[model samples]
Target: MPLNIDWRQILLHLFNFCILAIALYFLLYKPVKNFMAKRSARYEEEAAESAKLKAEAEELKKQYSDKLTNADAEIEAKRSEALHELHDYREKLVSEAEQEAGEIVEKAKKDASRERKKIIDGAGKEIADMVGAAAEKVVLGSTADAYDAFLNAAEKSIEKEENEIK
Candidate 1:
C-alpha cells in the first residue's frame, strides 16, 4: 500500500465540492430564502390588518353599548311617564265616580224626604175627612131618642181622636 495520498485526487474532490455548493445556492437556496421572506411578510401584513379590524370592532361595540344604554334610559323614562299618566287618569275617574255617587245619595235623600212629607200630608187630610164624616152622621142621628145615645157615644170618640191629634 502507498503511504502518500495522490495530489490530483484531492484537488479534484475539492473542486467538485465548490461547484456543487455554488449550483445549490443559485438553484435551491436563493429561491427558498425568497419564498420564506415573502411568506413572513404576508403573515406580518395579515397580523396588522387583523389588529386594525379588532380595534374597529371594539369601537363599534362601545358605540352600540352607548346606544343601548341611552335607549334603555329612554324606555324607562317613557314607561314612568305612562305609569304616571295612568295613575292620574285612574284617580280622576275614581274621583268622578265618587262625586257621582255622592250626588245620587243626596238626590235619593231629598226624594225620600219629599215622599215622606207627601205621605204625612195625605194621612192628615184623610184623618180630617174621616172626622168630618163621623161628626155629620152623629149630628143627623141625634134627632131620635135611640140615636141620642149613639150621638153621645160618637161625641166621646171624636174627643178621643182630637186628644190623640194634639
Candidate 2:
C-alpha cells in the first residue's frame, strides 16, 4: 500500500504462471524428452551392431588372408613333391635301361663265342677228312715213300688253312 504494490494481483499472476509451467511440462517437455531418449538408445544400438559387423568382417578377412598364405605354401609343396617323383622316375627308367642293355651285351658276347667255337670245330673236322682222303688216294696209287710225301704235303696245307681262318 505504501509503494502502490498490489499483493492480490501479484499472487494471482504467480499462480497463473505456475499452472502454465506444469501444463507445458506434461504436454510438451516430457514427451519430447522421452522421444529424444528413445532416439539416442536406437542410435547406440545401431552403432554397436555396426561395430560388431565391422569386427566380423575383419575376422573373415584375416581368415581369408591366412588361407591364401597357406595356399601358396601348399602349392609349393605339391610342386616339390611332383618334381621329386619325376626325378625318381627318371632315375628308375635309366637304371632299368642300363640293366637291359648290359644283359643284351652279355648275351651277344656269349652267342659270338659259341659261333666261334662251332666254326673252329667244323674247320678242324673238314681238314682231318681231307687229309685222310688224300693219304688213302696216295697209298692206293703209289708206294710207301709217296704216301709219306703226300702226308707231309697234306699237313702243310692244313696248317695254311688254319692260319687263314684265324
Candidate 3:
C-alpha cells in the first residue's frame, strides 16, 4: 500500500513484456529479414546473367569483324585477277589485229601486181593488131613487086617484136 513500491505488479508487467517480444520476433523480424535476404540474392543472380550476356555479345562482334576483313581481302584478290586477265586479252587482240593488217597489205600488193601484168598484156595485143591492119592496108591493090617488099618488111618487124617479148 505504499506510494513508491509494488513488487507484484512490476513482476506481472515484466512477464507481459517478455511474451510480447517473443511474439514480435517470430511474426515480424524473422519474416522481414528473410524477405530482404531473398531480394538481395535475386539482384545478384540478375547481375550475373547481364554480365554473361554482355560477354557473348562482345564475342559475336569480334567474329563479325574477322569475317568482314576476310571478305575485303577476297574482293581485292578477285579484282587483281580480273585486271590481269583484261591486260592479257588486250594484248592478244592487238596482236591479232596487227597480223590481220599485215595479211591485208600483202594481198593488196599481189593484186596490184596481177593487174599491172594484165594491162601490159592487153596493150601488147592491141599493138600487134594495129600493126597487122596497117600492113594489110599498105598492100591493098599493090603491084606484085611492091607487095613482096611489104610482106618481107612486115615479117621481119614481127619477128623482132617476138624476140623482144621473149
Candidate 4:
C-alpha cells in the first residue's frame, strides 16, 4: 500500500455509499413526492367545490332580496288600499247620518204642524159654541137663530183658516 491507503478498501466504501443513496431514494423520496401530489389535487378539488357553493349561496341571497323587495311593495299597496277603503266607509257613514238627521227634522216639522192644526180646530169649535150661546141670550127666541149664528161664526173661522193657509 502506498502512503498507508488500500485500493480494495476504497472501492468497497464507494460501493456502500451508492447502495445507501439508491435505497434512500426508493424508500423516502418516491413516497413523499406521491403524498405531496395527492394532497395538492385534493386541495384543488376542494377549492373548486367551495367556489361552486359560494356561487349558489350568492344566487339564493339575490333571490331572497328580490322577494323581500316585492313583499315590501305589496305591503305598501295593501296599506294604501285599506286606507282608501276606510276613508270611503267613513264618508258613507257620515252621509248616511246626515241624511237620517234631515229625515228626522222633516218628520218633526210635519208632526208639529199637525198638532198646531188640531189645536186651532179645537179652539174654533169652542168659539163657535160660545157665539151660539151669546146669540141665544140676545134673541131669547127659537134655538134656530142661535144655530144660524153658530154656523155663521164657524164659516168665518173656516174662511180665516183658508186665508192663513194661502
Best by TM-score: 2
The sequence of per-residue lDDT tens digits that candidate 3 reaches over residues 19-137 is 99999999999999999999999999999999999999999999999999999999999999999999999999999999999999999989877876865676577556655655666
How many times do residue backbones clash in model 4?
0
lDDT of 1 at 67: 100
Pairs that collide, model 4: none
TM-scores, one per candidate: 0.58, 0.65, 0.58, 0.59
RMSD, one per candidate, in order: 8.0, 6.3, 8.9, 7.5
* Candidate 3 Cα errors over 4 Å, as ranges: 1-5, 109-166
What does the lDDT read for residue 78 in candidate 4? 100
Global lDDT of model 4:
0.86
Give the per-residue lDDT of model 4 (tens digit) for 1-166: 6698988888999999889989988899989999999999999999999999999999999999999999999999999999999999999999999999999999999987997788688767779676768676567976777677777777777787677666
Model 2, span 1-166: residue lDDT tens: 8888899989998999999999999999999999999999999999999999999999999999999999999999999999999999999999999999999999999987887787678667766676676677676766566567656766776686577557
Please provide, for model 1 over 1-166, each residue's C-alpha lDDT reduced to its tens digit, 9 standing for 90 to 100.
2878888888998999899999999999999999999999999999999999999999999999999999999999999999999999999999999999999999999987887686667657756665565567667554354355546655665676566546
Best by lDDT: 4
